[model samples]
Target: MDRQFYIISYDIGDPKRLQRVHKFLKDYGKPVQKSVFECWLTERELESVVSWLADFIKRTEDRVRIYRLCRNCLQNVEFTGPVYFAEEPPEELIL
Candidate 1:
């Protein structure tokens, strides 16, 4: 399966809901900030992730965004200053 990159961000009105979302994202991606995550996922996984999160947010009060980045866009991403909070994937997985 091919995986595409996605930047997922959220703003939840309730503290409990925000925590829930945070925990969930941790299982699936790398957290770049308190409420932002960077994920590489297949189309099916992306849909599943969004569907799961939909259960936790209120339409009127919470906001969630998922930005799909093409290979070109991902390559063109720019960063500045210290990135202490940035998440790095493991260099190797040992089984």
Candidate 2:
């Protein structure tokens, strides 16, 4: 699938909230690293997911973000897929 991936970072105010968001992201993808989570969606779906996340955060007192994959795509950095979160083959995977 030819789609963009996102590395969302939420500056959640509290550890419990941080954990809450992390758990929520599990519905989307896995955590390839700490704080940073990976989730793949097309141009349109991405916006929906971001909006959902923002609204979710608004229900609480925390910070959220949806940094564009295009902006964060560096030359040499590998972090994608649901390796730590999926059993079947995920459409998006990076190593």
Candidate 3:
């Protein structure tokens, strides 16, 4: 299976809804920023994440953006400042 990388960011209006979205994303990826996550998923997994969030968010007020990264893009990502996230994905993720 080929897994692709995605950067998911959101601006949710309600605190409760924001927390829910954060928790849901934890199951799919790692947090790279307060409102951003980096996910390595297969196509189906990506679809699942979007589908679940579609129900959790209010289209009229909240915004969610999922940015797909090609292998070349991943390799070229530049990091500066405090490093709370891994520069590269783990070789193996348990669970």
Error of 3 at 31 (Å): 0.7
After TM-score superposition, the amount by which residue 77's alpha carbon in candidate 1 deviates from its true location, in angstroms, is: 1.1
Off by over 4 Å in 1: 83-95
Candidate 1, residue 45: the lDDT equals 80
Ranking by lDDT: 3, 1, 2
Model 2: residues with Cα > 4 Å off, grouped in runs: 58-61, 71-75, 78-95
List model 3 lDDT by residue over 1-95, tens digit each. 67888899999999999999999999888898899998888888999999999987999999999999998887687879864433444556559
- Clash count per candidate: 0, 0, 0
Instruction: State the lDDT at 48 in candidate 1.
Output: 87
TM-score of each prediction: 0.83, 0.59, 0.84
Q: RMSD, each candidate, Å?
A: 3.3, 6.9, 3.2
Model 2 pairs whose backbones collide: none
Off by over 4 Å in 3: 82-95
Q: Candidate 1, residue 51: CA error in Å?
A: 0.6
Better-scoring candidate (TM-score), 1 or 2: 1
Clashes of 2: 0
Worst lDDT run of 10 residues, candidate 1, spans 83-92
Tens-place lDDT digits, model 2, residues 1-95: 54566667777777886788888887766576777776665667676777777766754577776755552454355547733422223576657
State which candidate has the highest lDDT: 3
Better of 2 and 3 by lDDT: 3
